[model samples]
Target: MLAAIRSIIFIPVFYGGSTPIIILAFLVALFSESGTHFMGRLWSRYHYLCARLILGIRVKIEGEIRNEPLLYVFKHESMFETIDLLRIFKKPVVIAKKELLVIPLWGWIAKRHGLLGIDRDGGGAAMRQIIKQARKAVAQGRPIIIFAEGSRAHHGQRPELQTGFAGIYKLMELPLVPVALDSGLVAPRDTFVQKSGVITYAVQDEIEPGLGRDDIRDRVHAAINALND
Candidate 1:
């Protein structure tokens, strides 16, 4: 009953105010990202707060966030992980699908804040773009985060990872930081009832980028599976 009411009020308020709120926030983040690279950090923190306050989601960190630029590979369970990581990490360069850039204020903000959007279906073109953007972000000293599975996992299943990450790994040559999360399907797909629970994030040791493509993928997958054990 409480969750339902929260959804009722939050849904209308979110839809009604999303455009203006995102626009204002985008502008603020633009200046912040440009001036100090702290806007994304600030926006993420407040964004998480709003998610919790408006929808009743809770998050808990279980390990220390690494302090260097590396490829952050994590389980893709839900949108919550995306937002939550942004809030926790400092200037994390995210790799997302290009379609997200088509959204109004949100897309603009993502592009301006240095988020890398890939054309997942672009074949070689997409790989090239990812490598380009990723190298630039790494050069700027920001960790590159990739949802190794490529897309969100279903209620009881995990998605197969695309080989694109392998290409990025080989090209850029950076260490890999394996991250895992316990629960993110609390709200489920296409639903608004945020089941209240604690989300756990575990950051593992960094894997050097010199491993073979298959080896790298296997190692990252092992880390994620280890979290489930």
Candidate 2:
């Protein structure tokens, strides 16, 4: 019942309170992409505060965040870490669903802010296209970020890395840094009944570029699931 009460208050507080900030972000995008990123970071910071104050959720980081440009791979366990990584990694050019690029205002701004959207149905051709886009992002001095599994999974779900991970890693020629997080423990998918808990982000060491596909995949898979282990 107490959990229910917290979720009830938090559901509205998290969404309603964030609406204004998002609206402000749309306006900020009209002027400067950098200003838009500042707003995005602000938006993420606001949620962190809300998650802590209203839902009793805390975030713990287990490793260092680098400042250099490279490939950042993350575990996608819930929606919490999706945008939260913005503040965590400062500002990375995220590889997200192509559909996100169609979401009215947010999509347009996201593209301008350097989001690389991928169409999941384009098969090998899609992977090639994403690699092409990633190259441009790298040239612009931005690190490429992606969710290893491509989509969220239930708590304890250890799905293998998506097919594109290997293609991009090999072609991008950027060191791979895997980040693991346990957000589903508290901010689970498809529900608002959040519990008080620590959502831990485990950043593993960097794997050098040019590793073989099988070798890199195994290393990244293990690293990103470190928190689960």
Candidate 3:
């Protein structure tokens, strides 16, 4: 009860105070890519802090992330996992839905931070765009992180893996790191209420770049299920 109350009260104050700061941070991110990376890191630090202060939830990470220009296929459980990645990796180039880029200030900030937006309905063309943008990001020496499921999963169920990732794996021909997150549904979806709990992130084995697309997807799915079990 106390936790719920604290979370409820903290929402308004937290967002009210953080909005301006986020805008200022976004502006700083727009001018320079390096600055965007730095600000992204800074935003993640503050985001964790705010989550703790408001919801009493903590984040824990397991496994080591390899330092190389590669692709990270992560499980999309909730928005938390997305924010958490800012702290886990360096200068990550995220693949997100294009709709998010339409959001007012937040979308603008995401664009500045080097996020790659995809039109889910663009079919094969979307994959081509991803490959084009991903090549550029990888060339800059940043690991590209894609939520292979493409969107958040339903409560108590694993999300269906999307096939677009296969194109990325085949085109980029870089190492693919499988990432899994546990307990992200604590916050649920379409609601601001947060349930107090610990969310765990695990980085599993690297799938060598040469593997067939199906092989890579199978490996990543198995890794994610291991976490669920």
TM-score winner: 2
C-alpha RMSD of each candidate structure in angstroms: 2.5, 1.5, 1.9
Flag the better candidate by lDDT, 2 or 3. Answer: 2
Q: Which stretches of candidate 1 lie over 4 Å from their true place?
A: 13-18, 28-32, 35-39
Reference-based TM-score of each model? 0.86, 0.93, 0.91
Model 1 TM-score is 0.86
| Model 2 lDDT, full chain set | 0.85
**What's model 1's overall lDDT?**
0.73
Report the C-alpha lDDT of model 1 over 1-229, residue by residue, as the tens digit.
8777776766666556555556676768656766334555555666566667887777777677864678888887777787666677777788888888898778878877777888878999778877887788878888888887887774456555677878877887888878877665565556666666667777777788789988988888877644466
**Clashes in model 1: which pairs?**
none
Candidate 1 RMSD to the correct structure: 2.5
lDDT of 3 by residue, 45-148 (tens): 77778888778778777888864688888887788778878877778889988998999888888877778898888998887887898788888898888888
Ordered list by TM-score, greatest first:
2, 3, 1
- Residue 135 of model 2 has an lDDT of 86
Give the lDDT of residue 28 in candidate 2: 85
Candidate 2: pairs in clash: none
Best by lDDT: 2
Error of 1 at 130 (Å): 2.0
